[model samples]
Target: MSGAYLEMRNITKTFYGVKALDDVNLSIKKNEIHALVGENGAGKSTLMNILSGVYPYGTYSGKIILDGQECIFKDIKDSERHGIAIIHQELALIPYLSIAENIFLGNEQASKGIIDWNKTILKADKILEKVGLREASDILVTNISVGKQQLVEIAKALAKEAKLIIFDEPTAALNEEESDNLLNLLLTLQESGVTSILISHKLNEVENVADSITILRDGKTIETLEKDVDDISEGRIIKGMVGRDIVDRYPKRDIDIGDIVFEVKDWTVCHPLQDDREIIKNVSFNLRRGEILGFAGLMGAGRTELAMSIFGKSYGSNISGHIYKAGKEIHLNNTTEAINNGIAYLTEDRKNYGLILINDIKDNITLTKLDKVAKKNIIDHNKEYVVAEEYRKKMNIKSSSVNQTVASLSGGNQQKVVLSKWIFAQPDILILDEPTRGIDVGAKYEIYTIMNKLVAEGKSIILISSELPELLGMCDRIYILNEGEIIEEVDRSRATQEYIMGCIMEHSKEGKK
Candidate 1:
């Protein structure tokens, strides 16, 4: 309160009579990178939404003080007018629009009611250059990589001359290199006199970049730590966020790996759009019964491509692969075929591909296999409700009821619903792609425990993740993939982050030759 740039005092919000944020207080200094850390549903996003004016002044009770001036933001535009901006996890740019147009979409550079194309492109180019993006302003946003698109979002925020920018899960979709680059850009922006509020589950990034950190649990503030004045270790932040010390980040499980139960042989997939470009190059791997076999690779290394193509030909065209279950060859031409053959693939981008966000939890849970809750070829709503209710309890999904819309749940709860749907399908082999991405530490542990339970029941899993530590800790064996090829394999005891990175770097360098 002394001289903070922004002060949110006694902020409170409720949904359907349930408190989402209660008497939350946050103080962010000028030109500083402040981090908001919390478990899922801990009111971090809610508070940001209010600050960004997604929740209007009348909806939430609060005192928003900006530089000693009290203010009320009626909407997003109002907040933007006050030099506050928010870049959501999912970029808001239009796919078909050019980068320049998307940057100045609402806040356009115009003369006499007409958009000045030349001015727009020039301004956008400068902003993009400031953010260290090399792409041309006229290029379509969809044509660029996801990392570049993230930079475009920052440029958009800068276009409004945002003094305080909020990033919600900014690096959730980025790989290690891209994440590092973004963090560096944040530091550069700090030097240029812009304050940033980063909401992320990645504690390492918080520990590295944040000047101050605030921890929220449930709907209230737990504590705030100043990096220079307090012990701001990741463990300390995690303890505050979860309200307890987590001795083990990854739960240790006994390895009881059995014989190979699922196999993919000579899998080759060409790019779906570019017929001559190969995406997967004769990748061969196997998953043993009761084993968690991991695929570790950098972004665009074809791990997701291999998993999707084997699961159902979901990712590539002109796919050639041999998949075997119990030594018997299985031809899976579509997702239905894969599911019927006891295989399920959980997509990495769950918000876009997995659950129907508009649907209720009950509907989403039984969507995979309606026959289980059907009679005489007709879906029994009562039976489906009972089945969904049981899984909700089993999965420990947090919601008001099974009738609650999946969109209303937090990221972690939505993931649980996706798992529930697949678990209800009773697939023997589950291919999880970036399963723990964008979720908090507590939710991650719960999912890890569930994975162990699945393997103990003799089910096999193919884990494709960018996190080498997760792979080393959970998988029985790890495969290093680089540029669509399996470069090396390491057993659990032999796996190390440095070794995996070395393998990828070696193969990548040779490929460039």
Candidate 2:
């Protein structure tokens, strides 16, 4: 703790009688990677938010000492001006803008109200090169992959000349390749004297990069371990985060693969906007009635697009696909038809596309199939409440009441609500797109258990996941997609990390030719 760059003493924050951070004290050395590890509600983000001025000076009780001086930030701009830049889990990129434009968006390189495009691009190029994204500065933000978007976010911080950069789950959406690139960039930044405070759930990544680790639980500081600590294993980190040893990170479930229940054939989907560009090319697969069929792919490999295109052509146009349910052909021209034909897609993006944040849990749960709770176009509040309560209990949605707004819940609870909404629709074929993205380990285990139960109940599931481990752990069979095509289909017993990645690399190389 000698010559620490930042220190928080007796930090305390509360919201509506709930303590977010209680007398938390932490210190970070200059040009060091400090990891903040905790469960979803463990107040890690709250503390970081306070430090970054999201909670502001008066809202939270804390004394933030930066570089041996007292600091009080009233807003985000104040924090940025103090060389503290935070890249949130949810990115704030404008899709229509170019990468250079987004990088220097608010703080443009301008003189007398005139933007210097040449200087802006040049500066953006320097930052992008620093982040190992030299070729992406000219591309539109929408044209890039999610992983590249994250690097762009870092570039934005670099353009601001930020010293104490905070990354909140920066690698949550990135694939292995992209995640490695970002981590290596962080290391490079550290070598060049950039201090980073990383908030992440991936303990392996944390252990790999962090110079020190701080664990928080129940709004209290648990312990801090230096990089040289002999007992700083992932298990120890999890114990500190959850306050208990997770005997099995993934729950035990007996696999029971039954007969085929859902099947797709000759599926070829073109890009929704560009007619000549194909996103899902002639992909064919089958899902057993009592099995989880995992779709594994790298980013931009068409996993989510294929699922969305199949779940009522939501992703692509000029689509030529045939879907069958229980050995009978079905037509799903829209989401309503897909639902009516016993197919439901739980979107990967819960906040933007899945849940109505302004609505209460009761309203969101019954949104998809309101016909069941309506009489002569008049809604039955009692029935809707009953339905919401049943699904809430079934999914273990942690909410005070059904009347609680969806926005107020944590990430894990919001995910549960999204699942509940689809589950109450009584779909026989459930297409789950990254269902466990950005949730905690405890909540992930619960979701895995829920999937097991659903399969046991003779419901077929199509799980699309970027994390290969998740697909390998949960699916009975996996389709390794690459460039909108099914390159390899392997049974769970046969699929390996090496095999999946090898297939993708091969496919990508062939596509290049």
Candidate 3:
């Protein structure tokens, strides 16, 4: 085998007595898709941070050798100067800025003490075409779809002439089509001799694309396997990462469905932006107490939009719906009214709509229900701490302290914080949208337990998920949504992958009919 293009040796990092990285080592080949697999807090990000200069040379005990020579990165700029670019999990792009401006924000094509707009646009356009993002350079970052934004990020890296691009959960939020496009793009980049280090929890994608895979567990390197290795299955990778064979990644749960507690009738919601379009066309469903009602749909099938519209018209321009909680009509025109009327929505995009990143866990937990921890507009710090502390333990949030910044926590913990905030509101009906989207298997099991516990307490849950297995595993009843309509509802006893897929096809046929 050829010598690694980049190698990290004896990487040891600590944070207040916690060994974040315990003598970890890694090697990556040139022009190869190298995958780094690990559970959350297993030092994947930390190791990447060290390499990308998020933790500068002096801060961590490690020797980074690139192209057979020692390298010392004092800052992100120093690393970027050496052609190392990192596309973070949460994308960093100016929403209001045009794609050209965002792509060439720092690396402008300026001349003679003046900003050259034409040259900048021209350079951005060239890089955009290189990344297969043609004709999108003039569109505002906000106007483009998320898939395109991701490509723009790649274009930005290409603009910097990035030799080594590190994607930290690049496809975590992307749908199947977008993710496929990105993987294909990565392959194209590889063929063009650009090395990539991908950190992801999606094992299927890793197994499909990665030339080699390295497993990290509890901040220590386990082992690295080549793509053609004899035992490079998903189970093998999971074992290496977790140090044990997980016979079943999706935990088993018994379904005990009961009486209907929530129902929506003729739920017609207009598109939030396009006034002429109707997102939910006369959708209707019933959710039982002590049962999980899964809303299954493909991307853009109006599942999320339906949940948002039902949860106090959070996203519809023109809405007409009738909701009954515990068999009684309720008025929930806004989020406040919805919360007061025993409804809570845990958004799929947690960072944007769910948690305040800069705020501590305590502050975030009390955000939804400040009155419970406040006396006449005065927040009781002790009470707030007590409440946050309780949920942190209850939800098994792995954080240094409740005082720790929410931004500093892992994706799983951030999701828990979001759940804690909503649970504190004590809603009778809870809507969970892709709760386990980017989390690891262990974290997902914890969330599933939490869901079971919620149902045990007699609260109704509406789970909106893209993963069919999750819906089949957790929900007592599943509703198949297709193109802004409820095509079919299958009970837990009768639901199958084939039936669900058929429902999707049935809806398509009806639309064509």
Candidate 4:
């Protein structure tokens, strides 16, 4: 066997008296794309955190060897001194700063404490060219699309002269084409002798680019599979991560469709920052009882804008809409009003919008419906605990206890808490926006099962998703939106992924005119 460029042996970490990593081990070859896969809360991130020096050297009991030398890093910078760079999922770029400025924010081109603008721009432009980004380095980070911003992040890593780059859910926010581009870039980087450790829930992407796959489960190493030796498949990897075979990715719903329970008419919303720009244009839709109605569009297709505006005008300005519930027109002036009127919205940006990170699981679960656990405006602590515990068990949220902080939980468990919050509110119409964005396949199936359960109980659902396969699998009918307009409506029988993509493309072109 070839000597590994990086090796972590028998690593263990603890937080708040809980073992986050239990004698974990990892080995990566030089200039190879290595994938790390696991269920949420399976300790994938924790292991990576140790390697990145986020936890520092002494905090975790481990032996890290790079290039046959025993290494100890006290902090991130110490690791970076050895040419290690980690690009986070949420993106660390300052939005107001120029792309060049962001790329060299800390690692600046300077001589004797004096800034070198010419060198900075020249070096930044060269890095951009290397990454195949066509945008000028002077462009503000905010002015560029997310895909372009990702390239800037790569440029930032390149600036550090990194040999080993770690990418954590890098393509989670990107579109399909953008994801493909990023994967191709990773492959290209491999040819240039840049080693990578990819942490992602997207299994297909892992299969495509990874030369070796490492499966972690319950804070321990499960197995490592080499691409050329082991028969690597999504199913095989999933079975390793989950410890069982998943016969179905999407659960079957046997509920009967009922009469219209909620309806929207002539909904028009202007951008909050730019009043002249309409975010949602004359959008009309209805959800039937016991039905999963879908809204499909690419990024910035006004699907999220329409959902937010309809749910008590949470987004946009100058909104005009007629919302009806059970044949009676009702006005929802705010989020509370929307909830009281039998409507609930699950925000796509779960960390920023859907959750209060500092609070514990129990508190966050019952946060939306404190009234249900209260008597005479006084919260019943016992009742609140009971309710939270019930949802925790029901949602199968993997946590130490209900008292554990939501922030400390994994992304999948955190999402469950959010779902529990809204589900506790007991709204008739649930607008789920990207319900399974970055969760693992096991978690996705569980969520899909929950969706089925909700619809079977005669509830109405409006699913807004960027993934066409998800829309096709779970939705009864789909509405395709383009440039703030619903250009096409497809029934379940006719809603293939190809058909949906074609509709989106065709409508988007016409919208540009």
> In terms of lDDT, which candidate is strongest?
1
Compute the lDDT for candidate 1.
Answer: 0.92
lDDT of 4 by residue, 81-195 (tens): 8988888888899999999999998898999999799999999999998888999989899999998888899889989999999999999889999999999999888888899
Per-residue error for 400 in candidate 1, Å, reads 0.9
lDDT, each prediction: 0.92, 0.88, 0.89, 0.90
lDDT score of residue 364 within candidate 1? 96
lDDT of 4 at 193: 84
Candidate 4 local lDDT, residue 293: 95
Measured with C-alpha atoms, the lDDT of residue 89 in candidate 1 is: 91
Better of 1 and 3 by lDDT: 1
Clashes of 2: 0
TM-score top scorer: 1
Our tally of clashes for model 1 stands at: 0
As for lDDT, the candidate ahead, 2 or 4, is: 4
Query: After best superposition, candidate 4 residue 242: deviation in angstroms?
Result: 0.8
Off by over 4 Å in 3: 115-122, 375-377, 509-513
Name the runs in model 4 displaced over 4 angstroms. Answer: none
The per-candidate count of clashes, in order, stands at 0, 0, 0, 0
Model 3 TM: 0.94
The lDDT, on a scale of 0 to 1, for candidate 2 is 0.88
Mark the regions of model 1 whose C-alpha exceeds 4 Å error after superposition. Answer: none
* Model 2, runs deviating above 4 Å: 136-138
Q: Candidate 2 on 387-470: residue-level lDDT in tens?
A: 999988888886678888998777888999988988889999899999988877778888999888988888889999887888
lDDT at position 470, candidate 3: 86
